[model samples]
Target: MSGPPTASEDAPIRVLLADDHDLVRTGFRAILGVEPGVEVVGEARDGDEAVQQAQRLEPDVVLMDVQMPGVDGLEATRRILGPSSPTSEVRVVILTTFDREDYLFEALQAGASGFLLKNASADDLVEAVRIAARGDALLSPEVTRRVIARFSTPGPAVQPRRPPELTDREFEVLVLLARGATNAEIAGELYLGETTVKTHVSRVLMKLGLRDRTQAVIYAYENGVVAPNGPSRDGSET
Candidate 1:
């Protein structure tokens, strides 16, 4: 199966800066200025403006600050990635000074592709935009473990529900994905082409009605498809 297509090299990744701080936006612009194959197409001072500009500019990625005057980043992200948005192709990466776990969970639920720290290096910022633009997630290995550990534990919210029927191959892919495996890694492990892995990923997202990879990971955990630190049939850690 062919995977979801990534961004092509022919066009630069257009980005929209959505932050309440003027200095933050300026700093982001300055940082992204030196990066090749990236362009800042617009800026927004609040979540409402962010949503409006997202529709108008149709940027490939949005650098959304978690805190804004009105609507806030979480709501803006939801609206931007929601079904009624002008384009569902756009991706958002949440930026925040606080590394609160709740913020990360909420951002993912709001359809954000990643969570980035405000103090992250310029290189990190540049790389994050590139990753998000390519329809890939930006979760770090540490964050991945944290997310799994947190979500895998039983809770009133973690009610078990049946997942959509997936083929055995697709189930394997989802388990590895929840375990933080990259497409390339999964390809090597499964002895399939990278494009085929992508296709499987796209199918998984489609069948699961998920927006992106991050949601798929959460779904796997919530649906009991995999457990925190559990071993799989193939002897792989979940």
Candidate 2:
């Protein structure tokens, strides 16, 4: 499988703005226009238009509003990132004002790489776009806490799904990931090189059939790979 784009310093990140309100879209365009390595390539007034433009333009990142008139951003994100789509590599960043858990869960399940509040600053927005463009999940600490809580709840007696087969080291990497550790942090904690940690991360994502680290974090909790105040896959507390 191919990895995310490793863009050079000179290559600007292509972005597609998708929101129902024209003024909101315009404001976002204006903010992004001034960033050095970001360019708004297209605009979509609704979810349907977002999907169409994403397919046609294949931008590196899509700023999608969760609540649109029809089709909604959640479904549009799934369609754009689903395996059947031609531009499935496109990364989606869900934009919303509400901090509801349902939207957060749905967005992550739909394969969104980032979740940003509407009231975020211009710098946060630009950084989130660049992060998504580089194929990383941009979950704020607040959202991370929600993720932990949502997936850490007690469930039915029966197991949800069998755990994927992963190497011992990869399993350790996943534990740190579920604890919200970044690549460099994971490397330091594991006493491994950052590049090696990144490889293990990629392998873990591939093996789990997940879209990105955010989904992997969810998977770690839901499948009992890691638990709140519980031992990790290697039978050790994280």
- Model 1 lDDT per residue over 27-140, tens place: 999999778899899999999999999899888899999879868998898898886667566889899764677878888887788878889999899999988988888877
Candidate 2, residue 132: CA error in Å? 0.6
Off by over 4 Å in 1: 1-8, 156-164, 231-237
Error of 1 at 106 (Å): 1.0
Instruction: State, as a TM-score between 0 and 1, how close model 1 is to the true structure.
Output: 0.87
lDDT of 1: 0.83
Q: How do the predictions measure up, each by TM-score?
A: 0.87, 0.92
lDDT accuracy of residue 130 in candidate 2:
85
Task: Give the TM-score comparing model 2 with the true structure, all chains together.
Answer: 0.92
- Best candidate per TM-score, number? 2
Stretch of 10 with least lDDT, candidate 2? 155-164
- For model 2, residues 36-133, the per-residue Cα lDDT tens digits are 98999999988999999999988999999988998899989989988888878898999987556788789888888878889999999998898898
Clashing pairs in 1: 2-199, 3-198, 3-199
